[model samples]
Structures are given as C-alpha cells and as structure tokens.
Target: MHLSVENLTFGYGSKPILKGVRIDGIGAGKVAAIIGPNAAGKSTLFKCLAGILKGTGNIFYDGRPIEAFRREEITKHVTYLPQEGASNAVLTVFEAILLARQFSVSWRVSDDDLVTVSETMEALEIADFALRYLNELSGGQRQMVSIAQALVRNPDVLLMDEPTNSLDLQRQLEVLSIVRKATKAKGMTTLIALHDLNLASRYADQFVVMSDGMVYASGRAESVLTPQMLEDIYGVHAEVSIDSHGQTVVTPMCSARNRIANRRPEYAQLAV
Candidate 1:
C-alpha cells in the first residue's frame, strides 16, 4: 500500500495547525518516522491521517482517496495508536485485545480469535499480563497492551504516536523490533511519530521532519538529519554521525537559540 498526503490542512477555529503539508513515497513494508519539536503538530497530523479529526486535505491509501472509504472499510485498513495508553475500562488485557480483533468479525469469537490474541500478546512480551486488569497495569505495561491491541487488528496502515513512550530502554528496543518485523512480514505501511531522533534513525527507513505545521524535510535520515536541520527545526546544536553499527546517531550539544538570537535579534526572545 502506498500512503500519500497532499495539501493537508487542519486547525481549531481560527488557529491553523497544519499548513499544506505534503509527504510521499511511504509505501508498503516501510516504516517512516515523523519527527519534530514540541507543538509542531505531529500528533495533529496523525489524527488527521487516522480519520480521527476532520481536516481539509487529500489523503490517499493505495492510490484511492481516504474520504471515499466507509467507516468500517477504513477501520479494516488503518489502525491508529495514540500517545496515551491509559484505559479506564474494567476489562483484562486479553479481553481488550480480543475486542479489537472482534471489530472485524460479525460472528462470535472463535478459537482462531483467541489464538490471534495470544500470539499478539506473546509477540509484544505481554503474555504474562493477559489476565491483569487494564486499570491495574503500570503505564509501560498498558502501553504494551495498547500496542498489542493495535497489532491484533492487522491493519494495512499502522499509525502510531509515540509508541515507545514510558517504556524502558529494553522495552523500547523490543517494541520497535516487533513493529519493524511485523511491517516487513505483512507488508504494512507504518507511520510512527517519534521524538527521539536517534531511535527514529535506527528504526525507520525514511524520515519526515515537521516544523511549524509544515514539512521541513523528508527523505533518508542521513540526508534530512543534518546539523543545519537540527539548528533550524529543533533550535538545537547537534552532531549527526554514523555509529559503529552503521546507523545514524544524533547527539545534541546545546541550544541553538543563542546562535539564532545572535543572527536574528528581532526574535531574540526565543533564545530564552
């Protein structure tokens, strides 16, 4: 599947959040990371793509406009995982995952549904928490369960917002690995909103950098994650270097605000 966005615009009342944002070349079996500074509209963009927010734009999946699909049809092809994972539902982890899978099935849950939920839980290493109440699990555990819920749906396009948030180092790696593996195996188009540049560079095959509600840059990490981009978009001085494993690593040195203030005195207050 190919996912493309063009002239995407959205906002609340008079304040605009996205301005004619366009991204392309995100196809099946590929993981594209959406990176940007705080309040850069990353989450808003994901919401628009997932049909959670009504926005004026063109979103195409597999060369067809997303607006043409019915609600149920869209659900079959797209699964979105938001940033926060806490659920007040009284259901257990297994029940939550099973409910997600059951959305597509008209009949009663069968042996296959149970097996699929079990397999997804195991893949996420949350099988032990199957019987635990969702409200009782810790933040990280709930996040893992939320991921399992998304995976069980087996959508063609997976839109994840900060999927690794609240996770420890080990769990972070595990979640990303599982996502990458699943994307490749099922040829799914995965768009993940990530705050960590190094982690994004390590896992994503492509990068889309957003700034001020628009696309600042898009392409391979090495090409897009340059020192200049760091200074321009993130207002930070950073070093982008290839690690021993041949992966791109970003190390922040200092705030680029001082440098910007020196160059553009009119906007000096941003430095503070």
Candidate 2:
C-alpha cells in the first residue's frame, strides 16, 4: 500500500497548527520518520492520519481517499500508538492486549485470541508482565505493552507518535528493530514521529522533516539530513556524516546562535 497526504490542514479551535502539509511516496513495507522541533505539528499530523483529529485536505491509502471509510473500517487497516503509555485502566497487561484484538474477534474470544496475545507479548519480551496491572508497570514497561497492543492488531498502516519516549538506549534499539522487522514482514506502511535524529537516521527508510506548519524536507536520510537542513529546521550546528557501516550519523556541536557568535565576535552579544 502507498500513503499520501495532500494539502492537509488542521488546528485547535482557532489556532492553526498545520497548514497545507503535503507528503507523498510512502510505500508499503517502509518506515517513515516524521522529525521536527517541538510544537512543529508532527503529532498533529499523525492524529489526522489516524482519524482521531479530522483535517481539511485529503489522505489517500492505496489511491483511495480515507475519508470514505467508517471508524470500524479504518480500524481494520490502521492502528495508532500515542506518545505516552500511561493508562488509567485497571486491566492487566494480558487483558489489555486481548482487548486490542476485540474489534476483529467475534463476540467471545477463542483460544486463538489468547495464543496470539501471548505470542505478541513474548515477541516484545513482555510475557513476564502479562498479569501485571497497566498502572503498576514502569513507564518503559507500559510503553512496551502499548507497542505489543498495536502489533497485535495487525494493521496495514501503523502510526506511532514518539514511540520510544520512555525507553532506555538498549530498549530503544530493540523496540525500533522489532518495529522495523514487523513493518517489512507484514508489508505495513509505518509512520513514526520522533525527536531523536540519530535514531531516525538509523531506522527510517524515508524522512519527513516538519518545520513551523509545513514539510521542510522529505526524502532519504542522506538527502534530507544535511547540515544546512539541520541548522534550518532544528537551529543546531550539526555534522552529518556516513559511518563505517554506511549509516548516517548526526553529531550536534552547538546551537546555531553559538556557532555564529563564535565565528563573528562582534555578534556575540546577539547569541544571548
């Protein structure tokens, strides 16, 4: 499946957050990273795509406009994972995951449903927490369970906002690797909103850089993550280089203001 957004516009009551955002060429089995500074509308865009927040323009999935689909119909093809994993529900981890598949399963859940939930938990290495209450688990543990819920749905399109917010370095890599593998194995079109540029560079097959309320850049990592793009979008002086493994590495030196102040002493006061 291919996903495309054209002239998408959304905002709060009177304040516009996204203006004429356009992104194209997100193919199946590919992971696309949406990177931008805070309040740049990355999360809003994901919400719009997930049908949680209705926008003005068009969102196409495999050439069909998404607006035509009903909520249940959309749920069959799309699953959304939010930034935070905090749940006020008193349900256990196993029950929460089983509930996620309730939409697709018949009235009474069968043994197959239980087995599927179990396998998904094992895949995420969260089987030990199956009986634990969602509110009682740590933030990282909850985040892992949230991902397991999404994966259990087996959607064709997976939309995640800041999926690695509370994970440590090791867990971050493990989660992203699992997501990547799942996307390819299921031929799912995955869009993730992320703040870590290095992680985005490492896993994303395509990069969509948002700035202000528009798409600042969109393409492969090498083409989109240039030093100039970093300075323009993030206001940071960064070095973009390829590592021994041919992966893009972004090393941020300092703020753009500081870099300018150091180069020209006369403008040093402006940095403050």
Candidate 3:
C-alpha cells in the first residue's frame, strides 16, 4: 500500500519539468496532495506515479518498481482519474460508466460485475441518472461519473488530476469530501493534484509543493501552505487565513507591493 518515488525526473524534449524529484515515503492510509501553480508539472508527476508517462527515476509500490509493471498490471493496482477532457466526445454517463469495465469482457456482464456497477452508481449518487448520457448531464455530474469510472477498478492507490476543475463550490467540496471519505473507508491510498491550497490544507494529510521543476517544499499541509510558498509558486499575493468556523480561505490581493510588504524576508521578491 506504500508509494515510493525516488529521483524522478521528466520532460518533453528540451525543457525539463522535473529535476531529481524524490518522495521516498508515504504511509499506507493517508491522503497526499500535490500542489503547485499552473504549468508546474503537477499532472506530469501524477502521470509518472500512475505509469502513464515515462520518467528517469524508480517508483516503487509496496516493493516492486512501477516501471517494470505492465499497463494492465499497473491499472489493477493504481487507479488514475484523468482530467475532464474525455467528455468532449459524445457519450452518455451510463455508457461511460459501463465502458469503465471494458477490461473485463466483450459479450456479457457477470453478476459480480453488475453488482459493482450498481454499487458505484449508487455510491456516487448517480443512480437516478443511470440512463442519462454524458452531454445530457451537468459538468458537476459528469465529473462525478468520471470519478466513478476510476473507482470501478478499486485499486490500491487512487490518483486524481485536478478532478475539481470546472466545478462549483458546493460540488467541489462534495466531490473532494467524497474522495477523502471513500478512500479512507476502503483503506486505499490517495494522491490528488490540487490547485487550491486552502482546500488541501483542510483535507490533505500531506502536501508536496512543486516549483521550478522540483519539489520546493513538502510535509504536512500547514507547513507547506504558508503565504510565502503561495507567492513563490504563484506571482500573485494571497493571504491564507482561517475563518471562525476553521475553514481556510485564500484571499488574493491584486497589488504586488502589498504582498511584498507582507511576505517573509527570505521571499521578499515575491512582491513582483
């Protein structure tokens, strides 16, 4: 159930995105969140862990290197919920969910398969729309169905790629909470690529912050999500504060000068 990433590095052709990144340890039953600004190679890191992309270093799950594992074998142990790009085509929600089980058979669906399908549809609260098509459902519902597809495999680890994009606040919280609860209840390890640091602080047990093609910071959510870290990763000045209800709210102030005045001394240049 453990995931170990060692000296991992990747790139497109000329520009390197990850440089000797290594996360050699994670407990069996924890939620690790990866956060960084846009184009920080967050998705690329997730792909490396999921074996969707090739990297230079060794990634071990339990004990074996993930690079040595076949695609089917990888899929059996790790479930990756890709971004919502697949919905650009025309497929129904129910069709998409059913297609998730394509690795099983060609002609028929077994009793156990049907049971899994039924439970997934119900657990994701998409049971009533079981007959609905993809284009027919809202963006939020489509995201939910996409998550359901990933869970159908029930792998040892679930990796998500900005799964909350294009979602409203309510739906975002709902889906994120669902992922946290479901993964913990099932005793599976989960790693989510997140753009929202406040949300990560609220739910994630651990955080990996990426900057300049490398891990700039990592550890618990509180340690990794300081105001300086946000400004260093993003050019914007933002305040990370907790409300009376103990919810983290990220307030981004537009003026660069103010952030310069407020940031810590070591990261004073973040004002620009």
Q: How accurate is candidate 1 locally (lDDT)?
A: 0.90
TM-score preference between candidates 1 and 3, better one: 1
Task: Name the best candidate (by TM-score).
Answer: 2
Q: How much RMSD separates candidate 1 from the native structure?
A: 3.4
Q: List the residue pairs that clash in candidate 3.
A: 92-133, 92-134, 93-133, 93-134
- Model 1: weakest 10-residue lDDT segment is 259-268
Off by over 4 Å in 3: 88-91, 104-108, 242-249, 255-272
lDDT for predicted candidate 3 compared with the true structure: 0.79
Q: Model 3, residue 141: displacement in angstroms?
A: 2.7
For 175-270, candidate 2 gives per-residue lDDT tens digits of: 999999999999999999999988988899999999888999999999999999989989999998999988899999999988877889667666
**Tens digits of per-residue lDDT for model 3, 1-272:** 89878899999898898888888676666888888877788888888888889989889998789867888788778888878534645776666776777664454766776788788888777889887777787777788888888877677899999988878888778778878887788877899888877787777888888877788888985576677876777777777777786756677876566655566675656645
Which stretches of model 2 miss by more than 4 angstroms?
A: 104-106, 264-272
Indicate the TM-score of model 3. 0.86
TM-score of each: 0.93, 0.95, 0.86
| Candidate 1: residue 73 lDDT (0-100) | 82
Measured with C-alpha atoms, the lDDT of residue 91 in candidate 3 is 70
lDDT over C-alpha atoms for residue 35 of model 3: 84
lDDT of 1 by residue, 1-272 (tens): 89999999999999999999999769999999999989899999988888889889899998899899898888888999999875879999888889888665465898988998999888888998789899898999999988998998888999999999999999999999999999999999999999988889989999999999999999999899999999999889998899999898999988987665678866766657
